[model samples]
Target chain A: MPAVTVRDLTRRFGPFLAVDHVSFDVEQGEIFGFLGSNGAGKSTTIRMLCGLLKPSSGTATVGGIDVGRDPEGVKRRIGYMSQRFSLYELLTVEENITFFGGLYGLDDRTLAERRAFALDMAGLKGRERTLTRDLAGGWRQRLALGCAILHEPRILFLDEPTGGVDPVSRRQFWLLINRLSESGVTVFVTTHYLDEAEHCHRLALMHSGRIAALGTVSELKNVFAKRAVVEVRTASPMEAVRALDDLPSVEKTSLFGTALHVWLRPGQRATEPLRERLDGLGIHAESLEFVQPSLEDVFMDVVERAGGTAA
Target chain B: MRRLLFLIRKEFQELRRNPRMFPVIFVAPVVQLAILGYAATTDVKNVPIVVVDADRSPVSRDLIGKFEGSPYFSVVDVTSNDGDVQREIESRRAWMALTIPPGYGDAIRNRRPVTVQIVADGSDSNSAGVGLAYASSLIAEKAAEIALQRRPPGAPTIGSIEARIRVWFNPQLLSQHFMVPGVLALLLMVITTVLGAMSVVREKELGTLEQLNVTPLKRWELTVGKLLPFGVIGIIDVLLVVAVAVLWFEIPLRGSFPLLFGLSLVYLLCTLGLGLFVSTISQSQQQAMMTAVFFFMFPMIYLSGFIFPIENMPAPIRPFTYLIPLRYYLVIVRGIFLKGVGLEAFWKDALLMLGWGVGVLMLATFRSKKTLG
Candidate 1:
């Protein structure tokens, strides 16, 4: 059975449709990534699945329990953590673990066992007495994850959990998430980081309260398969893009750092023509070559097609 | 039940670690009670008076002697000039002035009624009114005494009726006796209501409330867990302030201690409910504190008959006092402390307070939902 299944789940706030008829399914022990920018209905959908919000229409089931009808039953089977870490800053690491465990109604013996496990898992075994506020961002994030999973829940939902963390800590946090998934705990996470989305087995790119694309990384990259994306390195990328925009074969152009990626119409090749055109415009092009599209290209393309500004 | 215990334990742990909370909870009540206990009295004493003895006759001097002898009045200056009375009063030196007109002694000896003029500063109207009443009563007593003495001994005394006034509950009429219990009620309402609101809203500010909403904890469990600690603190404050009232102020707790404590518990339900209600409407601790103080606490104190008598309030506003839970609590607390009355005397007020408590609690609970929406 799937760990989570959402069908036409919609949430409305007054006249605003925050999550509009969204649907998806996550298999057991899979890392499902929901990618979107700020206010793209990522957090709203997570909240509904976690039983923290009621769906305005449709249904969602977490661990086989309907969220709208039996939110508490769904709550019992899932662990949730957010970007804030939500640990009491005044409390010690051990106390937070014990407190969350008690909240899940863990017995004394089980609480002691899980307490040691959480301490070891978060690398906080030796710093059990340290206040949560004193810990660095990485440690606090891990401690929060440890607290959330103290009940050994079958499903875990992380809402922008790596926000405001250093790159190194984010990588370390993802490592812990990988370990949990290896242990057969389904992980559902939302993030705007394209690089982090690479870690997920499957990803849904949300745009304006709707899923713009849902597939594996390679499958999503297939949008540029028939078309040609040529990367051109030039000193003046802005001038190069403007020079290539009027060409019949050129569909669109986007600046990629100092280089520019030019998209051509399907079954059309423009590498030689683009170089010749830039040379004609008195713009020096160092290199021009057809390259594979990255996830950032996919996100921009998806959002542009969905008629929303890309973040 | 166990989850509730954990939540309560977390709340207390947070409170202990908070540096400002310790002083606000444990020390502020004692300090406020001590300061307000001595400063909030309405008992007027030692009204300074400038006596103008224009009539240098023996009878006039004897009346001036009566003013000087009374404990209520201290003659700041005795002069023959009647104009000194206005100057002394305008300069704020004397609260009242007693002027004796010329030929005041002959009028009295002739058995004719003579009027003595008294000018009082009405800026401080409460003390001025009390001082005027005291002066007139003293003069009437002196007149009666002189009338009895001048008559021949056993010469058919005329029948007269007199009132022997006796003040019940407080014989000395000490304002502290009434004010101390009122302060106790006010302190409990301020502390518990503000603390309750701030505690919940603090969690909201820290984002922990959202975190808790995702947990399997029931809504009522969360409510009871969050507010039960403050209720405990409220009871402790009642005990502490009651001890101060009894030991330091010497205000009698003539009623049963358990009964007082029990009624205070019911009153706490109202205050804590108010706090919860504030949390539901506020998004931050600062907003919660503001709402609890300006919106809830101020209105309760003003309308509860704590400082101003509800009876003296405008007729239309007096009916609103019935809605203030503190109004019922003040009656219960003062009845216990001064009148030594039991449930038999204040059953109606107690029942009303309970009704308000439960109604407010239900309203607050209904508004406090586990779902974010």
Candidate 2:
């Protein structure tokens, strides 16, 4: 059985549906990523999967326990870390680890063993006495993760864990996540960064409380976004993008820094249509060529096609 | 049980580490004890008296000496002229004026009734009335002494009825004895309710509530764990207040210590439960504090008859005092402190407190569970 199986789960706050009929499955020991914008219901879905919230309709099971029926059973098998720092800032690093460990009913012997493992994993081994608030942002994030995993649950849910950390720290955190997955722990994480999503074994892109796409990164790139993207380098990038906006062959135009990224529909040749349009408008076109579509390109195309309504 | 202990231990650790809360938890109680001990009182003391001795005899001197010796009376001035007596009282130097008539010495020798005038400032009637009563009792004692000296040995006293008043507990009727225990109730309310709400709401603010909810800890265990530390603080506060009341304020704790401690523990559940209920309804620590003050603390303090007498309250509002847990607690504490009553006499109040504690805690626990869900 999958580590998590969510079938048509829905959660409503009053009249607003925060998670609407969303369904997905996460394989055991697989690193599953949920990607979306700020209010795209990623946290809501994760909360339900972690048994912190009860779904308004449908059902979900985490670690073979029904979330709606035996949420406490699901709770015993999963660990969750929120986007914000959730450990007691006034407590020492070791104290935080022990508190959470005890909450999971770990005995003293097992707690001591896990404490050593967690401290080493967080690179907070020697700073056991240091207050959590005194630690730097990256160190605090790592310590929070360490505390969450002290009980060594079968599954872990991280809701935007590396939100504000520096790039180097972000990469290190990802390495820790990869290690956890490699050790047979099913990891479900959410992030807005497309690069982080690429590291996941399989991911679901959510938009307006609905799953827009769910597949491997390469599969999404091949399936939803099959059209080629024309990268335009021009002296006047704004005028070049504006000139390409009205072209019959150009599907969409997006400006990335000083370059213009133009999407062409299937069976449309970007070489002839793009050059003719820009030359007619007297815009300086330095270069134009077809490029492989990134995950970001697939996401933008899917969300736009999904109609981007408010949840 | 071990999980609850760990959670409680963690709570104390956090409390100890917080620099701002250190003085609040420890030092504030002592300072408040000192302030409330001396300032809150109704026992009359040091009533300044002006004696106008027109007779200037030995008898008049004895009367002056009597007023000077009493702890309740301070003889501010002595003059032969009645006008000086009035001047002394009108100038606010004295609260009462005792005037001896011209024949006051002769009348006392003959065992006759002499009407000595005692003038008191009526503007502040409470203290002035008590002062006059003290003066009358002293003079009456002196007259009884003279009559005894003049009477024949073993002769029957002429047609008189002597009524002796033996005041039982708190003979002096010192207000500190009353207010010290009352202040303890107020202190416990502030700590358990306000601080309790702050503790719970603070977890929500820090987003730790989300982390806690995902743990295997049961809901009631979590609630009890979050509240057990404050309950310990409440017990410590009770002990501190009791020590201050007995040692510093000199108010005797005549009842059973175990009884007082046990009853206080039950009462704490009501306050802490109220605190949890406040946090459930509030979204932030500030909101929790305000709700604890306005919604929980104010109504409980007012209707508990801590500062006001329940009987004197309006007919419409009097019955609501029964719903206040502090009302039953105050009765129990005061009974244990002054009257030395035990479970036999106050078993009903104890039962009511238990009922209120269980009822409030269950409701709060339900509300918190719903809020979390």
The TM-score obtained for chain B by all candidates, in the order given, is 0.97, 0.86
Give the residue spans of candidate 1 off by over 4 A: none
Candidate 2: residue A45 lDDT (0-100): 92
Worst 10 residues of 1 chain A by lDDT: A269-278
RMSD of 2: 3.9
TM-score, per-candidate, Cα-based: 0.98, 0.87
What C-alpha root-mean-square deviation, in Å, does candidate 1 show against the real structure?
Answer: 1.4
Query: Whole-model lDDT for model 2 versus the true structure?
Result: 0.86
Q: What does candidate 1's lDDT look like per residue over A1-311, in tens digits? A: 89999999999999998999999999999999999999999999999999889999999999999999999898888999998999999999998998999999999999999999999988998899999999999999999999999999989999999999999999999999999999999999999999999999999999989999999888999988998899999899999889999998999999987789999999997578887898888999998999999999999999989998976
> Per-residue lDDT for A93-115 in model 2, tens only?
99999999998899999999999
lDDT tens readout by residue for model 1, B245-275: 9999999989999999999999999999889
Q: What are the candidates' C-alpha RMSDs?
A: 1.4, 3.9
**Could you say which candidate leads in lDDT?**
1
Model 1 earns a TM-score of 0.98
